[model samples]
Target: MIKRVHVLEDDEDIRYIIGVLLKDEGYELQLSSSFSDLKSKLKDSVPDLFILDVMIPDGNGTDICADLKNDIFTKQIPIIVMSADDKNKDKSLGAGADDYISKPFDIDHIVNRINKLLVK
Candidate 1:
């Protein structure tokens, strides 16, 4: 089955880049630029993995990550958080993110991390 990935990022360029890269890897990509959009997308179906940006226009990804982890239905989904703040990696991880990727991240590394998480 093709794995589905949900990307929650407010930056258009970054969001587009991620979508293209993951699509190239044969994974279905779902993109959301705001909290409301993310919620609506989730209502439709949960993705195999989530790539969340720490700072979004509507809300913080860390808080969203926490909410997802605490929810019984969504808790099993793996999350990979991206942030420009390197220090937030620990915070995101503490919030139950499966992995943290800093901004200006290597695309190859991101793909590898996603692959590793999906394998688990």
Candidate 2:
């Protein structure tokens, strides 16, 4: 099955980069800039995975992660919380994120993590 991944990242360049990377890797992509956009998009379709930024424009990514994890519909979807701040790693995990990747991250690392989680 072709897996779909929803990404909430405020930086246009980073979002574009990830979209291109995932699309090339044969995963379906849904990109959103804010929590509201993510919520609206999810009403139509739920993704197999979520890549969220810790600092988003409309909401804290950790908070969003917690919300998703608490919901029965989205709880099983793997969530990777990323941030430029390495300090938020614990917070991300505390919020029920499956993984945490700090910014300046290697593209391969993210892709590898996605592959690993999707396997389970």
Candidate 3:
């Protein structure tokens, strides 16, 4: 089955690149830059995975990750939190993210992590 990935990132350039990379790997993507409208984006479809950026306009990604992990309906979906701030690596895990990726991320590393998570 084709996996769907929802990416909550404010950086347009980075978001597009990541979307293209995952799309090339045959996964469908839902890209959302607006933090205020995240719920709407998520409600549009159920994704197999989530790529969350810690810093976004008007919202915190770790909190969003935690909320999703806590929800019965979304608890099973794997979430990978990506941030340039390495300081939150542990916090992201504490918040229930399956994995953490530091920004300035390598394309291969991103692909490998996604592949690894999707298998579980």
Candidate 4:
């Protein structure tokens, strides 16, 4: 099955880069640059995985992750927290993110992590 990935990131450059990197990997991507946009996108469909940036303009991804994890419908979906704040790893994990990736991330490593999470 082609895994669907929803990326909630406010950084335009990083978001574009991630989208490009995953485009050829056969995963369906739903990219949102804002909290409202992400919510709107989720209203229509839920992706198999969620890749979130910890710091966003309107809200933090950790909170979003927590909300999703608490939701019966979205609880099973794996979440990957990508952030520039390395200190937030523990917090993100505590918030129910399945994986954490620090900023200035290596594309190959991110891909490997995503693959591993998808397999689980």
- What is the C-alpha local distance difference test score of each model? 0.95, 0.95, 0.92, 0.92
lDDT of 4 by residue, 88-114 (tens): 999999999999999999999998898
Overall local distance difference test of candidate 3: 0.92
| TM-score of every candidate relative to the true structure | 0.98, 0.98, 0.96, 0.96
Comparing 2 and 3 on lDDT, the stronger one: 2
What is the per-residue lDDT of model 3 for residues 15-68, given as tens digits with 9 covering 90 to 100? Answer: 999999999999999999966667887777789999999999978999999999
Predicted structure 3: clash tally: 0
Residue 20, model 3: lDDT of 93
How many backbone clashes does every candidate have?
A: 0, 0, 0, 0
What would you estimate as the lDDT of candidate 2? 0.95
- Candidate 2 displacement at residue 116 in angstroms: 0.4
Tens-digit lDDT track for model 1 on 1-120? 999999999999999999999999989999999989999988999999999999999999999999999999889999999999998999999999999999998999999999999983
Instruction: Sort by TM-score, best first.
Output: 2, 1, 4, 3
- Look at candidate 4 and give me any clashing residue pairs: none
Looking at model 4, residue 93 earns an lDDT score of 98
Give candidate 3 regions above 4 Å deviation.
Answer: none
